[model samples]
Target: MSELVIKDLQVSVDTEDGPKEILKGVTLTIASGETHAIMGPNGSGKSTLAYSIAGHPKYTITGGSVTLDGEDVLSMSVDERARAGLFLAMQYPVEVPGVSVANFLRTAKTAIDGEAPKLRTWVKDVNGALDRLNLDSTFSQRSVNEGFSGGEKKRHEIAQLELLDPKVAILDETDSGLDIDALKVVSEGVNRFRGQEGKGVLLITHYTRILRYIEPDRVHVFVDGRVAESGGPELADELEANGYDRFLKAQV
Candidate 1:
């Protein structure tokens, strides 16, 4: 089993003026097989936290530490952290103009497992995952996310998730740009990761729609770069009902 621990984490982004703090002494934990949702308004640093955990070079970890299954993740390079069992599905998945999906998946799969998946087996696995996402097999022949619709891009991210199968998956706004059907497809893909042995999920979103399908084990309300409230699934319902007003007021 694996665990992701964020202890006293403070993050800052570099600006011409200086380092601007985003996350303020935030700490959280996610154990294997558990799902945690991070909800917040825009500019609340929700995305910053996700990028920091994934070791994005643009963000500076001004303070604190991030550890994965007892290993110091902050000290590891981005590729090393992924090999160490961490995955981040970005809010805006990039377009690799010339890379075919099959080729990209194979390369990522090999990098993660340190062995190439057999050609026949890999094709079958990729096909099965595409079917689950309702993506056409023809997509595998096309360049990654090039000319893909918003919903298609999101589904493509889920496709990568199915292929990578990391120990922990941080989905930064996976619910964004997805229609109802696409949202359910993405949610189901995330659901498949739950297991008795363990796989952790950090779902960052602004809406409660995806939570209705995935049902996080815990919900955290982030306000002004820190967690303002933490609770169970019902917290999502409350956020949907009352919105982030109380959270914004509390931040003051």
Candidate 2:
């Protein structure tokens, strides 16, 4: 089974003021068959953690280590990390001009798999993935994330998550900007991925509402770049009722 271990992780970002630290000794583990939820307020470094693990150049790893299934994740390039089975669903999925969704998905799949999928089967799979997410088959003809609504962008990310089928998935604010119906639809896609054997999910979100649809095995309260506390599913329920005030105040 695959396991992603983060140990004493520290990260920084470059700004006009020089370097600013974001993640402070953040440590956690996500193993196959477990879904972990990271809940925090804005600027708490939740997204930073996701991006850093995915090898974003914007964030620098000042200290600590991140490993996926015993391999050095931090040392790998962004695309290398994906080929190594680490996937990131960005909070804001960028558009790829002139690249049709079908072509984009096929290229990514080929890159990750080291070969092209069978044409006939690939077409059927793509259509099925789109239909499951409530997207029309014609959606694949559009440029990736180009002129799509926020919900469509997020849904497309999940569709990729299923087709690509990585070992671990890091979703950054995936529930953001989704209406109730879209949230459920997106959540279903995430749940379907989690249902696969040896799949791991690290869902970063601001609200506990998404947790209601996709139950997390562990819930972490992130405050000031560190995980203040971690507990079972009940921890999410507590957060929904109480909020991050207690964790935020503990920092003072």
Candidate 3:
């Protein structure tokens, strides 16, 4: 039932001189049970698109609107959007020193659901979700991503996604710094999240290697802050074969 509609969205970042547009007019729609991949070269605004939709303060929306399930998302605050079932897994997850993973998970779960979970029930739920992702229970006692490796950091992000279970998940380069084993674990967690009611994913990455594990229903090539082309999984194959050179050429 949940759907994300991005209509002619444009974004810019603030500068002393003036605003510098990062995302051109862009439109896309994603419904439940669908996975969409957006691929482009660096500085193509792929990450900008994600940040704008999530209402990051640094990114300014100059044009268009983003609606989730018929509600205007651009007008809502960041926490409000998350509570409304929107989740963004950043490429570089920050470290929360002195905050245990267990505490962080509980807070996120409570915040997303708008209510604190009972201790007994919450414990089982948290443990079960961690087990599904092959994460050690001891990790819960450690500081949140403080000293974790690249793969561990990514896995921690995935763990948050699983625990939050937002209706729409925007993953920005989650596979960028992960190893093979970590990638598989992260992909498996994503797979488990998919194929369910009111679930959708927007995977933003430049490499097709992640697609090998998590198949996308559609792939869109982003160039010059707009979608240049969109097609099935074969588009990913083409990108793998020829890189983004052809697409970059077409954008010029």
Name the top TM-score candidate: 2
TM-score of 1: 0.98
Error of 3 at 223 (Å): 0.8
Residue pairs of candidate 2 with colliding backbone atoms: none
Give one digit per residue, the lDDT tens place, for model 2 in 1-252. 789999999999999999999999999999889999999999999999999999989999999999999999999999999999999998999999999999999999999999999999999999999999999999999999999999999999999999999999999999999999999999999999999898999999999999989999999999999999999999999988998889888888
Clashing pairs in 1: 33-199
Tens-digit lDDT string for candidate 1 (48-153): 9999998899999888989999999999999999999999998888889999998999999999999999889889999999999999899899998899899888
> TM-score ranking from best to worst?
2, 1, 3
Q: Give candidate 1's whole-model lDDT.
A: 0.91
Off-target runs (Cα >4 Å) in candidate 2 are none
Question: Candidate 3 residues 1-252, lDDT tens each?
Answer: 789999999999999989999899999999878899999999999999999999999999999999999999999999999999999998988888999999999998888888998999988878887787678899899998899888888888888888898999999999998888889999999998886776999999989999999999999999989999999999999999999999787766
Better of 1 and 2 by lDDT: 2
What's the true lDDT of residue 101 in model 1?
90
- Clashes (N, CA, C under 3 Å) per candidate: 1, 0, 0
